[model samples]
Target: MSGERARILVVDDEKVIRDSCTRILTTEGHIIKSAENGNIGLEVFREFHPDLVLVDLKMPGKSGMDVLEEIESIDPNVVQIVITGYATVSSAVDAMKRGAYDFIPKPFTPEEILLIVGRGLEKRRLLLESEALKVEHERIRRNMISLVSHELRAPLAATVQYLEVILGGMAGEIPSEAKEMIVRCDIRLQEMLELLRKWLNLATFDSPKMAEHFQDISLSDIATESIELMKSLAEEKKISLILETSKDLPPIKGSKVSLEEIFNNLISNAIKYNKAGGWVKVILYGREEEVWVEISDNGSGIDEEHLSRIFDEFYRVDGRRNAPIKGSGLGLSIVKKMVDAHGGMIDVESKFGEGTTFRIGFPKFFQRQKEG
Candidate 1:
């Protein structure tokens, strides 16, 4: 009774027992309420939301087990203790099966009643704490989604408006160099948008009811398309783009869209971080059970310390000070997530001031001789 006092409800058909129990609990500095029968007790339970409930098994209107079921339906976490006069071992076992926290005989001492009530109150406190933690976690997740949405949308919107003007010829007689610059900007914007979409999709996939789509597709074709998509950006920077893929490469079983996105992000990053007039090489090789793809670039390589956290969301190697080469910092993270979704593995090898290489391994699904 020295601990925190809890709100308790006493339910019994006997007026004397109900009143006496309420008096004893109230004297101990605990808030108490009394109900004549189980039906009335249920009404009081909804209104009071007591932390603990004490119900007599032999009731006139509704049985104690009935009351326990109703209370559990209202809030399963509410602690329930059963009291009975003709207490048999079987009856006590039955009460526990119906969700009662504990049982006490009618002729029990005040000390016994207080001890059982205290235990029930402690259980209630733990249930409330668990519910609070779950709610807090959900709130933080929502906040993260809101922040990422606002931060990613602004740059994408600007890029879209610029492209619309150029494509509409609203900016009349644009120079070839200026058009190419706009297109490069457009590509970066598209990359940012794709990263955002991947993050959102990953969240959806984490739900238990979501399904993943997998299919058999040619890894060589997917890699080639990704390389061609970023070829313009490489040309603009005077970077040489090379693709070395075996003609007899095996197909991979996975989501083609996800695979394409992963390759696109890696290849784009290789171009983005490469030095002017440097080179990017993409190679594909088929093994017995799996296929390997590597994208390597001659550029400013990632530092050893920062490489570990490169896959973290919104994590950038260069701070905001590096405006000319700044990125949204979600490309590699998205790539890693997509690879994981496909049940594949991806790794990065880099040395500072030298270059970086990203290697991905996929399970082979098609016969290499089909194309021949």
Candidate 2:
């Protein structure tokens, strides 16, 4: 009553009761409609589209309990209230379970109905307002990501291209010291560009769009390819790279690029963090309903305090041990998002001074297709 006026529907068998409720509610500046039976009530509900409904428990033809259930199926957010002569605990509970907001007894006062209706309308308003806010927030987030990515990347990329031209001696020859400084600057700027790209990838990960590109892909092939890509980096550290796969493994439906990113990041990290003569092993196989891949390393393992926050965005482990290791800290976060998007699971195991292992499991392609 204190907020915006609402369209209200009252469904009952007795004409007197309908007229009484219609008269009482109409005076409070609320639009009202009434039906003499449950079946007629459903018809009026579809056309009138009231924000709140008042349904009588005992009715001819379709019962009020059935009406409550059908309304819930159509639109669960629509507020529902029950009207009954016998307001027994069991009946009230049944109506509530069927999605009734509240119930008023046969001999109730106008004030009682008005109070219940007002509460229901307020709840409806809040639900609508919350949904609107969520849409607006998502819009702002998307716009911000676009702005940052374009504003920083366009100029930096152009600068890098010009530097490449100079380094190629296209313009003229230069002193060795000057050329070295230019190379150093180029390296740092390239690092910045890579970091910016990773940040955008994590921020703009749209699962629905990614799902459109999904195809049946083999985890064994993905793992083998990722190992080949990481071999150069591992060789520099004298870290041995090994991949083992089970034959006749089942495939999974996923975006190839996202799955590649997951494996690349995990394998790269394993090699970068390992000591000389250490090893990184990738094992791929299939289990019931899922294809599992594990990457393990004999590297400096994560401490207990740092493990919890490793998957968080821009969260780098702090201390002297990790000081020399440079990273954007967005890799694991991106990996986690891509895994979840593909209907997969990822887990990590580590002991402080021993080693670390990462396991990823994806639902099999045939099973996913069946579920869909």
Candidate 3:
């Protein structure tokens, strides 16, 4: 009745009260309906689905209290106003606790009805608008992430591969200095690629639709493969990629894509943040109830102050700023999210200048576990 038309229902045993309310509200460009008793009020409520309801506190068949409870059961947010011939302070307060939006005494002025009902309708419109805005913002965020992941990343990856070929001397021979420069450019390109990948993965996990697709699969197989994939990166820095996988390391209930993401990020960080000629060690052992993974590196270790926030998005260790390595700092954050979604635990222990260690435990039966 204020900015937008509203649906209102009035329930009163008195024909005069019902008729008076209908005439007053209907003149304000509102859709109004009336019921003579509480039972018929409920029937009209369902059929009309009115946004606001007015019911007399004392009725012949069923009381206004009964109709208020029934309306609450249907939708707790619906606005309700209680009416009575004798206005009592205690009764008005009690009606409010029963979920009535307002209480008016019998012989309410038409102006009083319009003012109270208008306020309720405005509140409902604001709540609905707020919800719509939130949904729209989420949709736009998802679209931007999808576009960057596919459109921008594809071209950058191709360029990195082409530069790798030139640095590898697949093209005509070039000066040693020029070759070194190309390698530096290649490394920067690779950093960009990793950032894009990690950022995209972070957004994917953030989406509500990214629910876990768990499966009973060999965790050892995925770990081994992730380790092998990082061997090349380790070699680039002259670091050794060592693995100690127990022969009986069993399967885990997890998403294959997410599990691979978790393992790859841990192993990749060990290499990226390590000193040249250092080593990355990956150990996989199983407890009776869980599988434990430990990846340790003796690279430029993280300080204690940074350890607490290492899993936060876009958080980079300050100690590594002057170091040659660069990153988006979302790697560990993504790992933590994927692990948490699978109902697993991940933690890190690091010494300022000595080294760092990461431990992960995956339960035998994850809640979303499915057969691979």
Candidate 4:
């Protein structure tokens, strides 16, 4: 029905029915995979990952219902259609409730089968598109929050500092315990202010103007400075910070500020998430035409599932786990965006309870620089 040709899986105990359905679908320019039993159908499902599954209701070993359950468990997005000669009203309704896209009665015409399969494929496409849009909308919303948070930081910092000055007797003397309470207020205010600043920086990078300001910058200098600046914070946590860089590395065309921000956020995160007496090692090297910078920390590693989504704005796994680490969760997101803006890529390798490593690559030459 759509411009996209679909892959279809036809599973039935009867070879004649299976071949007939496969032949019809194949003639319609659809890629078809066939299985004569429910067990083999599940294996084919995993391997083919078809756009639509046509399951016979009553197969040996595993019924269509059982196979449908397994498919739903593996990937809920797959559109399934129940094919049955025993298509009583109850059976049809039961199949629909069990996540079948539609129920097809057996001894059906080729036209009937084709119509059902086409509609199922269309539904699958719509579902996938909807899911993609949902993710995009969520990402945009998070980016907006990150941007607004950043914009709020400067004013917040000024307000907090002025309040601190007033409480510190710069303007007038305050009561003793009142001063203690004000001090606590100032601490919380400062923490909020820091979070706001991080959000603001994250937001700024999202802007086209800020994203465009990238050029060739020395990786070694950036790495060294970032590590040095974070040394104190790591020391406070009793974490050892180490830097290992290849001497005279090739310069990458990227925003110095963005690179600085990237490294600063990464190192800060490493220190923030690390256990006491842990170690953070930053290594910089060049391979062929690309420069690589990797930051590794002996902190609590993120789960494999989370590593893929950690770059999403405000995605905080630790916070979800009720860990004490304080952050706005925009750091990794910003890092990813900035690196992408610079025509680069970033990856994470981590193991739970051991540690995490964030590796980012930069191209030696940026297309934007050549254009300019």
Clash totals for all candidate models:
0, 0, 1, 5
- Cα error, candidate 3, residue 50 (Å): 4.7
Considering every candidate listed, which one attains the maximal lDDT?
2
Q: Assess every candidate by TM-score.
A: 0.57, 0.83, 0.67, 0.57
Q: Predict model 3's lDDT versus the native.
A: 0.85
Global lDDT of each model? 0.82, 0.88, 0.85, 0.85
RMSD of each: 8.8, 3.6, 6.2, 14.3
The number of clashing residue pairs in model 2 is 0
Candidate 2 residue 26 Cα shift, in angstroms, is 4.4
Highest-TM-score candidate? 2
Better of 1 and 2 by lDDT: 2
Winner by TM-score between candidate 3 and candidate 2: 2
Hey, what RMSD does candidate 4 come out at? Answer: 14.3
Per-residue lDDT of model 2, residues 137-166, tens digit only: 999988888787878887898999999999
Give per-residue CA lDDT, model 3, range 82-112, as digits (tens).
9877799888888888889888898989999
The true-versus-predicted C-alpha distance at residue 16 of model 3, in Å, is 8.9
lDDT, residue 74, model 2: 81
Q: Write the per-residue lDDT of candidate 1 for residues 1-372, one digit (tens) a residue.
A: 137888899999888888878877887889999899888899999999899999999888799989998888778889999999988999989989989989999887788888888888888888999999999988987787766667666557767887978856897888889888888888777766766766665544441121134567888889889878988998998999899998888777777777887888888888888889899999999877889999999888999999889988888898675567867677777788777665568889999989999998877753222111
